[model samples]
Target: MTTDQWVIPFYQKQFKWLRDAEAEMANYLQIEANNIEEQIGIEFNSMLDIGAGIGSIARALDARGIAMTTLELVPDLVEAARRRSPKSIDIHLGDFYTYTFPKQFDVVSYFDGFGIGTDEDQLNLLKRMKSWVKDDGSLLIDIYHPNYWRTIAAGQKMKIDDAERIYSFDEEHCRMIDSWWHNEHPEEIVTQSLRCYTVDEASSMCEKAGLTITGIFPGGAMDFDNWTYKETAPLSGCLSYRIKLTKTI
Candidate 1:
């Protein structure tokens, strides 16, 4: 499929909210940006935003005077992010897993886009992404919580705008599948998979990739929604987590 074929088109429309992100999601990100900076220590000079969906976090950080570069998989969104961001920032159109940086960055962030691939793809990408970070720089990524899947599963259909999509659970592979009508041609169908992982499972995957977890932040930056360290038990209730990681143990 073409770059703007299926998923890109859906995002192109769904992320229209991102065009005015400074006015839309700024308040939410602003409330926690200071805390995130303090926790990591030292303000970022150079940063890489992987899967920078329309530069949501990139623009937000740039607004604060941090130098930013975005790597987006979609050419259309990369064009959009470029148009929306300040002239100083650079936006690269490529996949993060194979793209090489001329030098390491002070921070490497992937956000919600971390869960876009399969289980092996997720692990391999995380392993490769570690090399992009400076020795002690942070890696911020989020995964959709597995607990949320158990409660809401199978045959659930919803119309996002006018397009209809169905949700199905794959018990054998333990992945959630969303099948929706094509963005350009509603008569055609498209499928996307979202892998859900418990906090412990995700942390273990990080450990395997040579990353050390420094902290976990709540989804939406709300106190009631948070993910903490778990030994063997699965994380429940939380829908997601903002994991902060470092390259060296």
Candidate 2:
């Protein structure tokens, strides 16, 4: 019943992304580790970064002696990340939902990839993450806030010549449609859809997965408005928030 055109050539081309986002990754690593240690009174011995785009965070953590693993569904991205990571950091090319790990991690993370499915699916991911963490481990996830997302004008489309890509948002479903094509073979194009979610909705999903909110990181550099992690800290007008969670048990 869906008439929207979706393509399949995205994988043919290399996407514009980071091989090593050193500065940003380091900043996030230090801030998050500090927050986790200060609040939870412990440091993460091991970590699993779901949807680890370029292995930036994994490499960063690896440099600090933390055991790291990067999981990505895209083969191309996974290969890129693997080549860019150190030997100590393990990189796997597979879907996080179904991929099996050798052992549980002390911390599980999903940056900018939380809202890729329906409410039930998102909850399912959280549940999966729960099983992948140690009894006292943590879950760090960056989530899309509804307010700023609603401000994005839907149906507006754009094309990038250099990237050879087209993009648009289907606001009704909170999905962004992305397509890529080769300049020589424009006839063959590929596309992907990404779904976004809000704070309350993601929190409810976390509860369903037997996780509890421990802290919220609001970074302006990361599109989160300046905010202190308080019970009454307002998240309005914020594009995203890094939510920290812990297993219920």
Candidate 3:
């Protein structure tokens, strides 16, 4: 299935558990906010979050006195964010590829949901994001790492409450596929496919889109056997990597 066809249903179904995990979500968002600050090396005054799941990150940054705006494509997620977030945050419901903002921001961030479509499609989005940042500002994005995904064995399964997820990789295309189903209805499955990129590949895409990669930070991974998450890992061993970029002059 295409990205537009799978994205909404995949996330909506997979993240249903998030609604009840407010405290845990808050802690994660706090760490994400701290990472943004540390990686960017600036006390940014304004930020725009793309694919901002439930505005959790926006809320976290907003609490730190930053003006936050969020763009999300899911209707349910947008409504949830509005209901829970403070009025100061500007939340928009639209596709980042087609949506336009009235003003540029000091920083733009996209976490966890970066690889969606073809390489050209990703490059197009990067070019659009560049226009949303002020000339002197930076953009921070989390890129899925191909190396880590390559290590996941096909048919790897995990059960969470009533739901189960199967992880697999598309070696030829370098994509990660996540399939989810309810234990009661094993016949029905919804999946999300994301393209993975190495740091060098990501750098080339950024350069072509008129952005320069200034920094790279390795992101953590999940130990499925122990059901625990490691907060830090080497670049080749991490689940993903965060990149800091600036508009090329």
* Rank list by TM-score: 3, 1, 2
TM-score of each: 0.79, 0.74, 0.95
105 Cα displacement, candidate 2 (Å)? 0.7
Clashing pairs in 2: 7-190, 7-191, 8-190, 9-189, 9-190
Q: Pick the winner on TM-score between candidates 1 and 3.
A: 3
Off by over 4 Å in 3: 1-3, 17-19
Q: Candidate 1's residue-wise lDDT over 164-243, tens digit each?
A: 67777766666667677744566766676677787788889998889988887656321212323331223354556678
Q: List the residue pairs that clash in candidate 3.
A: none
Q: Which residue window of length 10 is worst by lDDT in model 3?
A: 15-24
Candidate 3 yields a Cα-based lDDT of 0.88
lDDT of 3 by residue, 70-155 (tens): 99998888988999999999999998888999899999988888989888889999999999999999999999898788794356
User: Local distance difference test, per candidate?
Assistant: 0.70, 0.67, 0.88
Best model number under lDDT: 3
Tens-digit per-residue lDDT, 35-83, candidate 2: 5455444766788888887787677668778888888877677777877
